[model samples]
Target: MRQAVRSQFTAQRAPWALHRRPFSTSYTRSGYADTLRNLRIGSHTRVIFQGFTGKQATANARDSLAWGTKIVGGVTPGRSGEQHLGLPVLPTVRQAVEQLKPDATAIYVAAHQAAAAIEEAIEAEVPLVVAVAEHIPLHDMLRIHSILKTQSKSRLVGPNSPGIISAVGKCRIGFQPLPCFSPGRVAIIAKSGTLSYETVASTTRAGLGQSLCIGIGGDILPGTDFCEALAAVEHDPDTDAIALIGEIGGIAEMEAASWIREYRSRAVSPKPIVGLIAGIHEVPGRVMGHAGAFTALDEPDAKAKITALVNAGVTMVHHPSDIGEVLREKLQGGSSSRQGILSGLGFGSQRRQMSTVSRRHRTSAQRAVPQQKRHLYLSTAQSVGLLIETDRTIRSGSPAATANSQYLVGVGIDRSSRMPCIIAGHPLDVLSEGHLKRFPFDFQRGPVDIPAEQIASHLGLRNQQTAIDSLSRIIKSLVTIFYEKEAFLLISHLMETDKSLTVVSARFGFDDAAFRIAGRHQQLHEMRDAAAEDPSELEAEQSGIVYLKLAGDDATVGTLVNGAGLAMNTVDALARLGGRAANFLDTGGKATSETVKKSFEVILRDERVRVVFVNIFGGLTLGDMIARGIILAFEELSLTVPVVVRIRGTNEREGQQLIARSGLPLFAFDSFDEAAAKAIELSRR
Candidate 1:
C-alpha cells in the first residue's frame, strides 16, 4: 500500500493539486468514528447566500466566486428578481432552495437577524448552514440549538465565525483569506481566526498543505465546536494530522484534550494532533479582545490547557509559526519513502533546526549565568505576570568583559496596591523594566522611602555617593509619576565606568483612565493620534457607554446591550437576519434604568437607525430596570420609532409586564429570536 501511494505520487508532478489524488489512506483511517460526510465540504458542494443582495453579501460572494466556490445563487427579501455578482437572487431561502437545490446556505445576515436566517435554512432543510456573522445573542443561539436538536439535516458552522473551508476540495464557505491556503492532508480547527490564518500560511509555505480549516468562532458559545470538528476530521480519509488551536477561555480546550486522549487510546494508529493554546499572558479577570477569550478565576489558564494536550499525546506548540516545522519533524523526518517525500517538497535539512539552535543558545546562556548579566525592563498599561530567568533572559549580545557583571533590576508598581517597589540587587543593578512571579520587599502606596544608601547596597554601585543620590532622586521621581501622573516607569542601560554613572534608557507608560479624568491628565490625552481613531468610538467613550458605529449605510437597527460581548453578539444577530446595526452600544454592567433611556438617546443619535434593538441579558443589570428605562426613554425622547426589547434574566417577567402595560410602540419578547426578528421587521418598515 505504501509503495502504491509512492508510485502514484512520484508519477504526478503535483499530486496534491491533481484531480486524480490516488493516495493510500490505509494507515490513517482507524475506522472507529461516526461523522457527517458534510463535515468535509467538497468542490462540488453548491452554495447559496441567505442575505444574498446585501452589500456585505455581494462583496463576500465576489471573493468566494473568485476562489472557485460553487456559488449557485442567493436569497434577498424584496430584491428577489435581481442579479448580484452574476448570481441570481431570490426573496427567500425556500425559494432559493426550490430553484438552486443548494447543498448549503452561507448566511451573510446580521447577528441580530441570524436566528431568523438560520431558522429559515433549517425550515428549508438545507444540508449545511454556515453563519459568518459574529456575536449572535447567546439567548438567540440557545434557541437555535433547541430548534437544531429537533432536526439533524442542518449542520450549523458558526454564529461568530469565519466558517469552514476545504482546501483540497476548493470549497470555501466562510470569509477566510484564500491566498494563504493550499491543498494538503492536515486538517485545522481553531477558535482564533488570526491564529488559524497564521497556521494555514505557515503550513502551506512549509510544503504541508491543508485538507480543511474550520474556524469554530471565538464567541462564548460557538455553533459547531472543537469536538464535533475533531470527530469529522478523524473520519476524513484525506486528513492525516490535526492542528487544534484553542485559547484560554472556556473548558472547550480541556474537553477536546479529553476527547483526543480517549479516541487515541482506542484507535489502531491515531493521527498526530498538534495543539496551540493562546492567551498565555492575559491578566486574570479580564476578557481579552475576543468575546470568548477570557478565563474564569477557577478555570484553567494557558499552562493547564497546554499540559492537558501534552498529556493526551498531542504535540503542542507555543506559537503558530512553529506548527508546520513541528508537524514535518513528527511525520516525514524518518526513512520511509513516503516520509522522505517531504524532502522533494523543499523541507530538506531544516527539521528540528530551530530547536537545536535554541538548545545550544540555552546551554551557552546557562554557562554564562554566573559570569555576566544585564538589567531587563518590561511594563504595559496592565500589569503582566512573568517568569523571568535572570540568567537566561540576559541579552544574547556578548556579555561585558568582567568577572561579575551588573545585576538585573525591575522598577514597577505592585498590582495589588499600585505602590512603587523596586527589586534591588538580587536581580537589580540599574533601573530596568520587568516583572517576575514571586513575593519580595514590600512598600507603602503613597510615598516610597528610597534612601541613597539603600540604592548603593541593592544595586552594588560601589557606594558612589553622587551616583547613588542621582539614582535615588530618579527613583523618587518615578514614584511621584506613578501616583501623580498615573504612569508606569522603567529605567535601564546603566553605563557605569570606574569614574562615571550615567542613565542610558527609560520608558514611561501612562494609564488610559488618567486621560479620561480632567486636569493635568489632559496633557497626556492630547498626545493621542486623533486622526487615526474612530470619532464615534471616542464620542462613545466620553459618554461613559461603549459605542462603535459600524461601517456601511445599510445599518438600520440601533443595538444596545449591557456587556461588550453581548453587544457584539447583538450586532452579529442583526447581521445574521440580513439586518445591520447603526452602532454598538454597551450600557455597561453598572447601567441603570436611566442608562437605558440615555442609551436610547445615543442610539437615536445615529440618524441611520430606523429601529432600536435593545437585547440585554439581566445578569449584572436587571431586566426590569432595562425595561423601565425603555419606557422612560420612549416617553422622554417621544420615540415614535419602534423599540424591540429582548431583556432576559433577573426579573425578566416583570420587565416584560412593564413593557406590555406601558404601550409605547415597543415590542417586548421573552425569546431573543422573536425580538430580533421583530426588530429586523420594524427596521425594514
Candidate 2:
C-alpha cells in the first residue's frame, strides 16, 4: 500500500493537489482507495436505479451521469419501456442488465420500497448497490443484507445515506455535495452524511482536500463498516492521515481501536486517525437519525467511543471546526488548541450552570472471588461433624461442591458418626500467594468496632478462622465454582450453622454469593438441584453450534431493516416466534429482476435452510422483484420447497401485477401474523 501525501496549508491558500500515483493492489482490496493517488474506479462499472423515475432519482442520475457514472438503466415497473433523462427504463433489473450489461446500481427509492429495490439490484448481478432512501424498515434491510453476504462480490451501501465519492476519478454515485470536495490525499469517512460535508469543509478550510469521502450510513448495518473503511485507508499511500466520524451506536469504534492497536504494534506504517463521535442525549431504544443507529450495550456510548479512540492515541475533537485544526497539528507537528477551545465553547453553557448537588454518588464495587478461592477447613477431630454441617451449607449455595464432596465420600453416610466442628469460608482464596503476601489488614486498627458485641465477637473469630483455613485447606475439599454460583454454598452454611458459625461464615463470604443472592432475592434460600427421573439426564453435554432458518413476511420487513439490526431482531423474533432462522437475508426494496432470482438461489444453496420464508413489503420495492424472483427460481433453479411472501408499499400495485402475471403459487399474505403463520406452517410441512 502506498502512503498518500498529507496535504499542507500555509494559512493563506489551499493546498496543491498531489500528483497521481499507483498504489499496491494489497490496499485496494481492503477498500482504502482514499490513501492512494492512482486508486482507480473501474470504468467497466454498471449502474441501475430502483426509482429512476422519481424526482430525486432523476436529478441524482443526471448529476451522476454528468460526473462520469456509467448508469446502464433503471427499474420502474409501471414506467418500464420508457426513457428518463435519455436513460432507458426497464420493468425489472434483469431486463436492464440484458440491455446495458452494467456492474453497479444506485437506488433512489422511498424508504418503504428500499428493501425490494436493493434485492432487485443484487439479482441483476450489479457488483455494487447504493441505496439513498431513509427510514427503511429494519427487517427488510436485514433480508437484503443476508442476500449481500451470500453474494459476497456485491456490496450494498445504505437504505439511508449520502453515498460514496471516489476522488481518484469522478465517480459521484450518491447525494454528497461535489463542489466542497476535491480529490487529494486524505480519506474522510463518517456516520452522518451532513457531518461528512462538515468534515470535508474543515479539511478544505485547512488547505487539506479529500481523496475519497465515504458515508457508511448512520444506520447500524451499512454496506461498509468502520473497520472495513479503515482497512482501505490504511492501504492507500495518497492518504497521509484518516479522519473518522462516528456516532453513538454499536461497538464499531471500539473494534476499530483494537484493530488500530494491533496494526501499530505490528510495526505497520500507522496513519494518524482523527476521531469524532456524535450523539450524547439519552434516547432509550430509539435509533438516532439513521434507523440502524443504536447502542446494544451501554459502554458503546459516545463518551466511551471517544475514550477508546483517545486511548488508542487518535486525535480527538468535539466540534467540526476542530477537525481541521487537529489534522493540521498531526500532519505538521504544531501546537493546537482547536479541540480544547471547541469543546469548551460547545460545553460552556452546561459547565457554567452545572450543579453536583443532585448528582448520584458513584462507587466501584469489588468483584467476587472465584469458587476455587473459597477454601473450607476444620480440625480433624470435628471433620465428620463439620462435613455434615458443611454439607448442609454447600447444598444451599454450592451444589457442585456439595455434590462433589458427596461423590467423594460415597453417596451414603452413617449419621451417628457425624460430629460437628468449627468451619470457615473465604471466597477470595483464589488470588495467588503474591496477592495474599500483600493482603491489607489493619490489625492495629483493632478489629472493627461493632454495636453488637455478639456479632462482633463472631466476626473476629470467623476472620481469624478464614485466614488460618486459607492455608489449612490444602487437603480437605477445596471447591471452586464460578463466583456467580456461590450462593448455593452460602445458603447451605447459613441453614446448618448457629449465629456464631453463621457470622464467621458470613464474614468470610462477605460480598460473596451469599450477599449477592440475598440482595437480589431478599430471602435466605437453599440451592437444590432439580431431580431427574434418569441419572443419564445429569450427564454433561458438550457445547455445539446450531444454525437456524429465518423467514419473514411484510410486517417483519417493516420492523427490522438494517443488516445488523435486522439480524439481531430476526434472531430475537424467531426465538420469540417459536422457531429459529439459520441466517439473515434481506431482499432490499427495488431488488432488480436478477437479485430476486439470485436470492432464492442463495437460500436454496444453504443445506441448513430446511425452510425459507419470503417476506416482502411493497414499499420502494415493486412486487415485480419478488414476482420475478419466484418465476426465475422455478424456471432456472427448479426450486420445489416452500416459500411465503407478503408484499405491500410503493410500486406494490406493480409488484402484485408481476405476481399475477407470473401465475406462480407463492404463499402470499396481507398481514404479518398471516405471513408468520404461513412460514411456521410451511416449515412444519
lDDT of 1 by residue, 1-685 (tens): 2243223223424211222212121222322122255667889899998888888778778878887899999998888677878889898888888989999889988766887788888778788888877555443454455455445567788766778999998888877767678899889998766567667866886788899898887765576778789988887888988999887666677678778878998999888877777655433434444555555312455555666666677776544555776776667743222221112212222122121100111111122112000011233221121111211222222234452454333354322121244534422211111222111222211222334455555556764654554444344444434444444334333444454443333334444433332234675555555565556555555666766666678789998887554554456556656787787677765579777887887778788889998876653367788888988887788897888887655466788888899857778786566788888888888
Position 40, candidate 1: lDDT:
72
Each candidate's root-mean-square deviation in Å?
Answer: 24.5, 23.6
Instruction: Give the C-alpha miss distance for residue 124 in model 2, angstroms.
Output: 2.3
Q: Which stretches of candidate 2 lie over 4 Å from their true place?
A: 1-44, 78-81, 281-286, 333-335, 340-685
Give the range of the ten consecutive residues with the poorest summed lDDT in model 1.
356-365
- Cα lDDT tens digits, model 2, 504-524, are 122122111233212332222
Error of 1 at 454 (Å): 61
Query: What are the TM-scores, per candidate, against the unseen true structure?
Result: 0.47, 0.45
lDDT of residue 36 for candidate 1: 50
Clash statistics: count for each candidate = 27, 77
lDDT of each: 0.61, 0.48
